[model samples]
Target: MVCKLPAVFLLVPGIFLACTSLKPVQQLSEEARRGLGHFHKLGYNYAETCTMDCTFQKVRTFTVDRRLNCECASYQKADSVVWGLFRAMEQYWMGLSELASPGLTSYDLSAPVQSLHASEFVSLSEGEVSAIQKMAEFAVNTSTGRFRSRRILHYMKDADPHLRLLTEKLGFVLEQNLLGLLEIQQEEWYTHYKTQTINSELNAMEKEWATEKHYQLVEDAEKIRLKVVSLVAMLDLIAEKHHSLAVTAEKIGSENFRNITAALSDELKDLYVVFEQVNE
Candidate 1:
């Protein structure tokens, strides 16, 4: 059983000196009081988290507005979900680049290097297997659901060269730019790490190792981060633009929904304030 403080309301009559003939208020049992206390605590915790989340959402929305209002408004006016999808694609790519690992893989080796035979090798150890499994599971679950831009393209598969054309463009651009960065990093590593006394064979092996690692990084970045980002951004943009249009249209038809939306947005801002507090 938990102890609980009496509610302020329970003391109101005493403070007011209401000398009525009514019986004294019923006393709460220890168990009940404890339960009430726990309930209050839980409520407080939820309120705190909820307030913070709302604040963050508002701040995020506002920041986007400040920077991309023109795009938002224009895309909304066009009433094409595709614009929002495109924006989502951009956002997704940006998020991946900013938030996720670029080139390195996380894994626990299947076994120590010592465990490998003198002639045999374990390319992917146990740790590596787990990491690969996790990565694959994450991709399969989130990518198609969140990243696909079906709504943007709609049924115009024939006329919409946007998907295929952009896919190729993005692939090539990322491969050259980001992959090139990986290559340069590798070359620098070799120049700095290889020992001067190493034999020609060892030197060659070191160089090869550097190149292989660089290649793997580039490949992983493209597969995991770049691809996901591009698709997610496009989809997000599409939905956002469409949502704006719907809001605008509803506003023109009925003012009530518009006001409600406005109020909701205000509450959202309050929530964003929570995030600002955390970030600061």
Candidate 2:
């Protein structure tokens, strides 16, 4: 007999919530079920790769748009595994839509996406939860950048050979370019926002001093304002990024929660550091 799942099992926390315990979800067609499983695994896979490869080592801060971009798209173009995973999810969503709302015209799925983030799931099997938990832990320990040579510097190193090919082709490109882009953004915090603000204020002070014949006072004022403005910009940026990354991390946890209690604490802490740096 097929074991029936609870109706409200999708509301677990941490890595455990990633697996659905609801009967409705379990009842999905084999392809849909497989697709959902694959989709959830992608997040763990990325985390594992990050842990193994240290992919985010140099990424001090990044803009929101940059975070979503897979840099390897250009090199692998039509065959990026990460992008492919995204597409696969889209297809799964479509399949679900056809099943849930047959003959309904122009149904929007934005709510489902939001619901996924809001709900949690319990796993039917402890082993499945354990595997995912391992990946999350790996992500925490690695802090990004070790997976490259061991996993995908030349080719993907996971169990799937095709996945290895895809990762080697696309992962390599994304890891390199994304890290560079993150570095650029991190540098911009100091140069663009901090230095620019300081320089602007200093220049204004200088112009005022020249006009009033108060050269000494002007230099002193410019120096003070420059330091003050730079400090302010740095603090503001760090705070903003911290908040944003924190929220995103929460969303990830909620959407794919399986073992709620264990995953939340560490993931939240990881996000806090990331956000703190962003704010800095």
TM-score of each: 0.21, 0.22
Residue-by-residue lDDT tens digits, candidate 2, 1-280: 3443442332232324233122221122222333223323222223333332233333324333444444443334433555674454345434533433322222343354344334454323444444444444333323222221122212211223432243343434334443334334344433433443355556876555444543443443343333323332322232232233233332222333223322333343443444344333
- In candidate 2, stretches whose alpha carbon ends up further than 4 angstroms from where it belongs are 1-82, 85-159, 200-280
lDDT of each: 0.34, 0.35
Poorest 10 consecutive residues by lDDT, candidate 1:
21-30
CA deviation > 4 Å runs, candidate 1: 1-155, 195-280
